[model samples]
Target: MQRRRFKETSSLEERLDQEAMRLREHKLLPPGWLREQAFRKARQMNIAAHINEWLASPGLRAPI
Candidate 1:
């Protein structure tokens, strides 16, 4: 088996800036506060989905 080496990646801020520029170019960028709110909402939804999946999996059981 060959081991894969990971390369260094850009920082989170850099990635976010790049995304923002893309959005701006496409005229889809939202206001700063709205963008922040949307990010928070997206994170919450992702966490909720993960928790729901864990609850539904067969390996775990609920206590009576």
Candidate 2:
């Protein structure tokens, strides 16, 4: 069996621009919007995880 190797010839900026253009063409989000959305999702996830951990810890589980 033979394996094929692929090379990335484009610069990082070029790749990013191409991706942003593709997103725009598809009526999806541009890079900034996508970044903001991802950040918001990550923040929400972190908050949820923290709350879960707080609830699970015996010291922090005291009733209000």
Candidate 3:
């Protein structure tokens, strides 16, 4: 087996922003499983992004 990797042309913020917008579009649907699926993914993505941001915040370090 072989592993493949490629460069990401967009920044993390840019990618997340685009994905968020895409998920929001799902809300236009009346009601269905697809909308729920998108909602869950969006929620997970939002939470993960926030958690990562908090973990990387400078306040997490011991005070000097």
Candidates in order have lDDT scores of 0.59, 0.59, 0.81
How many backbone clashes can be found in candidate 2? 0
Best by TM-score: 3
Write candidate 2's Cα lDDT for 1-64 as tens digits: 9999989898444555555444345334556776676556555555665666667779976678
RMSD vs true structure, all candidates? 10.1, 13.5, 2.8
Give the distance in Å from residue 47's predicted Cα in candidate 3 to where it truly belongs: 0.7
Error of 3 at 27 (Å): 1.6
RMSD of 3: 2.8
Better of 1 and 3 by TM-score: 3
Residues 19-62, candidate 1, lDDT per residue (tens digit)? 54443453344557766666665555556656666777788977
Q: Which ten residues in a row have the lowest lDDT in candidate 2?
A: 20-29
lDDT of 3 by residue, 1-64 (tens): 9889899998665677678778978999879999999988887777777877788789898887
**The CA-based lDDT of model 1 is what?**
0.59
The runs of at least 3 residues in candidate 2 whose Cα sits more than 4 Å from the true structure, single-residue gaps closed, are 1-31, 60-64
Summing lDDT over every window of 10 consecutive residues in candidate 1, give the lowest-scoring window.
20-29
